[model samples]
Target chain A: MGKYYKTTPWVIPELPQSLKNIFKKNGKKISIRKNQVISGNDETALFSNTEKLIYIDSGLLGQAYKTYCVNKPYAMSIVLPGRMVNYLHYLEIDNSGDIILALRKSDIFTMTKSQFDGITEKDLKDEMVRYCKKAVTSDFDAMCCMFTCDTPQRLAYFLKALAESFYDDISTMPLVEIPLKLSYAEMSYIMHTTIRTIERLLPKWRSMGYISTRRNSLIIYK
Target chain B: MGKYYKTTPWVIPELPQSLKNIFKKNGKKISIRKNQVISGNDETALFSNTEKLIYIDSGLLGQAYKTYCVNKPYAMSIVLPGRMVNYLHYLEIDNSGDIILALRKSDIFTMTKSQFDGITEKDLKDEMVRYCKKAVTSDFDAMCCMFTCDTPQRLAYFLKALAESFYDDISTMPLVEIPLKLSYAEMSYIMHTTIRTIERLLPKWRSMGYISTRRNSLIIYK
Candidate 1:
C-alpha cells in the first residue's frame, strides 16, 4: 500500500526573507494557515510575490475543485446575484496531498448557477473536478511533489511564476489601477480554513512586519 | 467663479446591509474601494462581485484624455510595467461612475516608460482636461458632474448596475457570488486608500453579519 502523507495543518515559517524584508519596510507581516488561498489565476496577485505555495491549514484542497467554460479565458464567479461573471476562473494544483477534483466545460450551466447560489469552497472544488479534471490532474500531481519541499520554498516558486503571468508593462499609461479581486475570506476557502482563523494569523504577520496592510489590501514584501 | 469642490476621499464601506445579507447566506464578500477599479476590458475583473462599484473618494473622473492622440476615458490611474499594451487605448466612462480603462487596444510605444511611470492619478485627470480643452473648457468641469456624488451613494449605484450586468436570473440562485481577481493592495491604489483601512473595515462587516468569506470567492446575500 502507498503511504499517503497528508498535508500538514500548521502555519510554517516558510515565507522568504526577501518578502519579509519588504513587508517590514511596508509595515506588515506574514503568516498563513491551511485552507487559505495565497493566489489564483485571472486575478492580479497580491504583493506581486511569485513564490507560489498553496498555504493550507485545515481543508482538503485536493477535494475542492471548480471549472468554467468561457467565451475566452474569463473568470466565471461573482459576489452578487448579477449578470456578469468575473474572471475568477483558473486554479493551480500541485500536490497529491492537496485535493484535485475533476470538472468539465460542458457542465458549466449545470454548476454555474449553483456556484453562484452559494456553493461551499469544497463544493466549488468538487464542481471544478467535474468540469476540468483533465487539466487539473497534472497540476495536482505537481502539487503533491512540490509539497515535499518546505512550504515556503514551494510557495516562492509558485509566487514568482504567478507574478510573471500577471505583471503589466510600464510603458502604457494605464489610467485605472487594476487590483487583485479575491478577498481574504475566499482565499481562506482555497486554503481550506475559516475566515476567523485566517484573520487571526494576519496580526502576527503584521507584528512581525512581513506584510503591510493598506485599507483592504495586504502587500507582501518578499 | 464656479465653486470647485475637491472630491472628498470616502473609503468604501467594507460591508453594506445588502452585502451582509448576501454573505450571510452565501459566505462570500467582494468589494471595491472608493476610486478603486473593479476590472478592465479584456483584462477581466480581479474578483467577481455580485455587484461592483468604483469608490470615487474625491477627484475628477470621465474627462476624455489623450495618450497617443486618441481620446480615452479617465478613471483609476494604474499601469503594468511590461509586455505589449493591451486594450488600454480608450477609456470607457459609464454614467454610473464606472470607468473601464482600456489597455488591450492601445499602442505600446505611445509614451516612453519614464513618461508613463511618473504619471499619477492626479496627473491622469489633469491630462484629460488638457486633451479635451478644444471642446471642453477644463478636465475638472467635464468630470465634476459625475464625480460629485457621495462615495456610498456612488458605490450603491455601481453595485446595483454591476448586479444587473452579471447576474439577473433571480429564480435559480439564492445568493450571488463573484469570482475575484485582485489582491487587496492593488485595490487600494485604485480606490485611493490603503490596505490597512480595508482590513479594518472587512471584519467590522463580518461582525455586523453583513458579509462572509469563501475559499476563492465572495458570497453576497440578495
Candidate 2:
C-alpha cells in the first residue's frame, strides 16, 4: 500500500484590496433547502450561500454539493422534448395506444375505435427494458474504458461530451468555466465520509494541481 | 487559508487478476539519456519504448520529451510547430517580420507582386508587438472578469497544454493501438511523482466516489 501524506496548498496569500472589493461588489449568495433541486433542464442560474460563479449543494439523498453536472448520454427512446422526434412512438404499439387513449379522452380523436384498440403495452415495455439494459451496458463499458485513462484522456473526453451538448466545434473551443454546485458537506455525503475528511482532502487536491477553489468557485483542472 | 491534508489511498487487499493484468501487460523497462530528444513530430511515437503501454523509468532533460505538437491556429503566425491555440494568440503579435520574410521566400504567393513587395519586416514586427501587449493585458482582465482563477487554474492550463501534445481520441477514430513510444525511464520520469501521489490519494477519492483505479486503469466519477 502506498503511504498517504498531507501537503499544504500553494496559495498566493493576501489578495490586493482592489480584488477583494471587486468580489464584494459582484458576488451574490443563495440558499438551497434540503431536497430542493437547484437547476434542471429549464433552469439557468441559481444563487447559493457563499458567492461564486456557480454553486451546487446536495442536502439529502446524494452528495451535499460541489459536483459537476456533466451531460449524461441517454437511449433513443429518451428523445429530447421539442428537439428530436421519438421513433419509439411508432415502434411500440402500447405507447401508440397511450397516445390514442389520451387523444380520445381529450375528445379530439378522429380515429376509429378499432384503430385505437389494437395497441398493447407488453411490447412497448419489452423494448424499453431492452433499451435500458443496453444503456446500462454502455455505461459500464464507458466506465471501464475510463478506468485506465489518464488525466489528459479524461479531460479530453469530458470536453468532447460538453461540445456535443453545447453545439460547438470541439477542436477550436476555448477552456470554459465549469460550474460546481456542491458544498463541502454535500461533497462529504457523496464521498461517504465526514465533513472533516472532505475538509482535509480539498487542500491536498489543491496542492496537487487537480483543482482550484475560490470563495465558492471550484475550477476543475483540465 | 484552507487547511491541507492528504488522505491515504484505499488499497484493495486482493486485486482481481483481470485488473492486475493491465499493469503487468503494459509496463515496459527502458531509459533515455540526459538531453536526449525523446520524440519529435517526424519521429515515431513520442516514447522510445514501443512494446508496452506503460513505461516507467528515470532520466534528465524531461522537458524536451514533454513538448507536444498541435495544429496551428487560424492566424498561424506565432503558434509554435505544436501548441493548443489559447485566447492569448488573438490578443498579441510578438513579431511580424519573420512572417513577412517567410512569405517573401515562398513560391506559392497569394498577394499581387506590388502588394507583396510593399510588405516590410518593420511593419509586420510593429503590428505584432502591439498585438502582443494588448493580448497580455486582455488575458489578465479576462481572468478576473470571468472567474477568480488561481494556481490550480494555472496548473490545469499547463496540463491541458501538455495533454494537447499527448492526448488522442482513439475511440472515435481509426487507430491501431496508440503509437505510444516512451522509454521506460522517460515514462517513469513523467509519472513517478504522480503515480505515488495518486496511489496515496486514490483511496480518498474512492471513498468520495470521485475516482476508481485498479492496476492500469482508472475510472473517473462523471
Candidate 3:
C-alpha cells in the first residue's frame, strides 16, 4: 500500500510562467499524518494560519462533516493530489462545521492571503478564477451524483471518480487502482447506508469480477 | 398569493459608488415566466446571449436537476431576490444536466461578459469574488444539511434557509415568511423523499406552531 502511495506534484495546465514563478517562490510545503483533522471543530480554535491557497502535493483529503446526531465525523468531497482546497474558507464564505481532513499521510503546500492580494496581474487573476470554477463544478457534480444515484451506482461512480483523480491518462489504463484505504464503515457513511449493506455488497461485486481488494487498496477492472 | 408575489430589487451592502455606477450603466433588466428553464439541456442549445452576471431583482429561482432515472425535473439551491446567480455558468464551471429555472414569475438584471471584463477596478473584482464565495458557501451548507439531517429536520432547515434569503433582517424577524410557491411534490424532490411523506409531515408541523401555509406562501415562526 505504501509503495502505491505516490503523490503527484501540482501542475495547472497552461499556467502563465510569471504566475508560476511567483507560486514557486512563495508557497510553503508541509506534511501531515493519516487521519489528521486539518480544519474544523476543535482544530479551528488552534487554526491561526494565514495561508490563502492550498495545493495538495500527494495523498487523499476530504471534507469532514459534523452532524447533529452522528458521534463520529464522516467525510465526503474527497480531494486528490494536484488539486487545490480551502479557497472558500480563506475567502470567509464557509464558516460552517465542515472541516478538511487528511485521509492518508499527505504532503501539502500553501500560499498566504496577502501574497494573493499583492498579485495585480490580470492573467494570474483569470487563472485563479478558472481554478476556483473547476472546484465549484466538482462540488455540483458530487451533489448531483449523491442526489440521483442508488447506493451501488453511487459507490461505483465515486470509485471511478477517485481513480480518475489519480490517473493522468485514464484512457489507457486497464485496471484502475485506488490507493487510499477506505473502510466499509466509511463507505457506508459516504453513501448514506448501513455497514452491513456495504459488507454484503463487496463480495458480490468481487464475485462479478468488477472489483477486487488487496491490502488497503481497491482495483476496478475496465 | 398574488399580492405576495413582490419582486425585491438587487442591493449589495456597502457597495462602492464607482462600481455601482458601472453596474447601473451596463446591466440590462429582464423578466421571465414561472417554470422557465434559464440554462442547461435543450435550453443550452437555445442560449445564445452573452450575459455574465444575473442579479435576482424579484421572485424565486432554483437549480432544476434532471436525473437519468427520474422523469420529472427536481429543483434545489433556490435563489431569491437580492442574491446573485449565473457566475458558475458564466465562468463555465457547471455544464452538467442541472438547469437554472424561475420558480415563480421572476425579474432579473444581467451584465454581459464583455462588460464585466471591461472593468479592471480591483474593488469590483473583489466584490465579484465575494459574491461568488457566498454562492459556494450556500452550496456547501445545503450539501451538509442533506447528508446529515433526518427528513423532518432537513425540511425544517431548508425552509428556514429559504426564509432567510427573503428576509431583510433575519435577526429582527419573529416570523419569517417564504414567498415562493413550492408544491409538496417539488419539496419531496428536493428533500429526496416522497410527496406522501411531505403531506404527512406538513400538518404535524402546522400543529406544532413551527410553520403554517397561507395560499402558496409558507410562514415559519422563529
The candidate that wins on lDDT is 3
Q: Pick out the ten consecutive residues of candidate 3 chain A with the lowest summed lDDT.
A: A1-10
lDDT of 1 at A170: 21
| Whole-model lDDT, model 2 | 0.26
- Choose 1 or 2, whichever is better by lDDT: 1
- Summing lDDT over every window of 10 consecutive residues in candidate 3 chain B, give the lowest-scoring window: B1-10
CA lDDT, every prediction?
A: 0.29, 0.26, 0.62
Per-residue C-alpha lDDT of model 3 across residues A203-222, encoded as one tens digit per residue: 89999999999897899998
Candidate 3: tens digits of C-alpha lDDT, residues B1-222: 011112111112222455445555677777888877765565533242234466666787776555454643454666666666665554455555556777789987777666776764776777766656555555655665565567897787677556645665666788887766789877886776788889999989899998888887888887
Give interface RMSD (Å), model 2: 23.2
Better candidate by TM-score, 2 or 3: 3
Sliding window of 10 residues with minimal summed lDDT for model 2 chain A: A1-10
Lowest lDDT block of 10, candidate 1 chain B = B5-14
Q: What is the per-residue lDDT of model 1 for residues B91-128, given as tens digits with 9 covering 90 to 100?
A: 11111222333222221123322333244356544443
Model 2 segments beyond 4 Å from truth?
Answer: A1-15, A23-222, B1-33, B36-169, B172-174, B193-222
DockQ, 0 to 1 scale, candidate 2? 0.01
Q: Model 2 clash tally? A: 37
Residue-wise C-alpha lDDT for candidate 2, range B112-201, written one tens digit per residue: 212322443555434433433333332222222111222233222322222222334222433122122333233222232233443444
Which model is ahead, 1 or 3, in terms of TM-score? 3
Question: Candidates ranked by DockQ, best first?
Answer: 3, 2, 1
